[model samples]
Target: MGESSWAIDLEKQITTAEVDEEEIKRWVIDLEKNMEEEEMKTSRSIFKVPTQTTLLHKNAYEPNIVSFGPYHYGKSHLQLMETHKKKAVDYFLKNYGKPLNNYVKALEEVDQELRDSYENLDDEWKHREKFLKLMMFDGCFMLKILYEYKETLAKPGSENHDHFNFDPQLCLYIRRDMLMIENQLPLLGLVTLAAVQTGKSTVLFVLSFCYFLKLESNSKNSPYSNYINSTVFAEHTGVLNLPILIMDEITEISFLNLMAFERKAKGMGSAVSSFLAFMGSLINSEEDARFLRSKGIIQSTLGNDKAIVDCIKLLGKDMYFNPHSEMCLTQYRLNQYYLNSIKSWNKRLRDWSSNFMQTYVKNPWTLISLMVAGFVLSLTVTQTYYSIHKPK
Candidate 1:
């Protein structure tokens, strides 16, 4: 049993005291004591982020997740739309970006469908045309639109998604930090667009952000904030945590104002109201997540072993989480948020359906059809999530 009598063993038992995370500490403790004693060893601390994040020049140009609310203060919407446009513009101007393709055009071609399905119906079926050209469908006109708007909008062709679609799309995922910035946007102004249910957009946003993190972790630099920055993918988290805060004070302030003012406006649009409600979810999510994270006071792998999960869930929605050595920081927590958001969203969706059902209770079958569609959207989201996380 002497240390010298040991066979060729490169193992060290993982002591509960050495593991910084509460979850990991519990996990190790749950293992057979003998195996753990023989397997664990003194390990280096894996907390802290890098001093400077390496960023891809292209990523700095990548789309931004937005908290675009009502259209009047569309400075937010403009930014979001520009993000998509950046992709289109990149195809011709940037370097090696892709074309918008027919998917966008299909929407344009289905004018009647747009009229049939859209609440507002007619004014802007073609208004988005110029946007389509500069974003989705490239044409000779793109250069002209790019030319005229360059001086006014951000460096012209370099406009980001934030400038284009203040409203988040399935593709636009706002980070916690983006809305946290002072005067940029309020926490509530952000759309839980990345969530799966009520705000499936939130789920899409986070998934997309993760993809960016993965890509930026490549040999290139990534402009994404450190919390989820891919640039520091390797290298031990070091002193600099991989997370960065994303805050937009203006967005938040404007959103509060927009809600107060729009409610009394004479010609209020349902789209505008619906959009505001969506933006409000971000705040609700932060509140709820924070409450959940604080449930049992667990430690994290972040600096000084702080309660990072709690922070991001509540006030930290504006913050991105950094990485820890040999582990994925906040993955479980983030997934939990996604699941919770999805659950809430589904319930809200049902509420909306119930309202629609009452309107068509006379036919009964119409009520049945709407219910079917809601069911389908829900299933689509489930399938999407499973496919993304399937035993990889």
Candidate 2:
């Protein structure tokens, strides 16, 4: 009886070992499948702020007035915009003559691709149905804003037609909120929805968006307005050259988010990074801010040159920039420009000239003495010349 019991126990041990091996094999296969799926979705664009960057200025990455994407969708502070978003969506669909279901279906098609663009999405938001609804609302809200801005620009008095057109300051905040890194919907999503509504080419729609950015950056009376308007409307075939480096609370947030996106997307040589680097190089001091103001490069409503300088300096802190990127090249060019500036000259002749002016030309008493000495010397020279050659 004891021998029979030992054999049964030995057989049970072997069976358990075989079952463990089978479970291990199943786990490996599942892991490989998950990895393959991740690889297929690796081309992400939008991202959560890295902890390192967020620690520098958390508020800059957050939307103050409105939230567009799922990242900030459920915040208590941002919930007020939900009604506004619904109204905008309704307005957009009504104008486009499409039912809300049509837009919902359109977004559903690209739901997975849209999900892939954002990182660290919550488990609740990971549901396909919930994410699709988010894309429809947020995407349409953005398109509505852009479409309204375009209409307002094309027809000066058309802003009154929009229900959400508030005070200028509120509008300014909304504009700034839209550009916040975390507050963005995918450009492809916006373009796709716009195409569904307007039947306009993507290129033209993007250009119109660029035009809105330009107009937002510049004041109505800005001297550069004409040039910017012409460049955007002219026969240019490249990306629009929007001036995004202005030193202000809004622009600083906008650029920081854009720079963050460029960094995450591995677009190290992008125009956004280059512009930021260029602006950072140009704004190291109050004098630098003043110089940019004189050149019409800084169009900030924020008061005081020091404020602009400080804002720019703050924006550059904790930023990740590649040394060999286009932004670095822009920094190199700026350094070269500074080295060639007249203020940077320190040659012997320049030193002597500066010293001479400071000592003999700057003080009233020394200037008067120099003038007297010059007159006396001129008289002496005239007298000596007359004595030598006067009646010869």
Please tell me which predicted candidate would have the highest lDDT against the true structure: 2
TM-score of 1: 0.21
Question: Model 2, range 1-392, lDDT digits (tens) per residue?
Answer: 36698898999898886557888999999999999767744667677888888888878788888888788888888787788878878887777797777777778787777877777778998788887878877777776676677678788976565778578787788887877667777777886777778766354444544543443444444443242232231112322233433455566766677777776765334555544555666578989888777767667778999888777777678455568655565456545555655464567678899999999988989999999999999999999999999894
Q: Backbone collision count in every prediction? A: 79, 0
Using TM-score as the measure, the top candidate is 2
Model 1, range 121-152, lDDT digits (tens) per residue? 23443466542332232222222232234343
Candidate 1 least-lDDT 10 residues:
42-51
Model 2 worst lDDT window (10 residues): 227-236
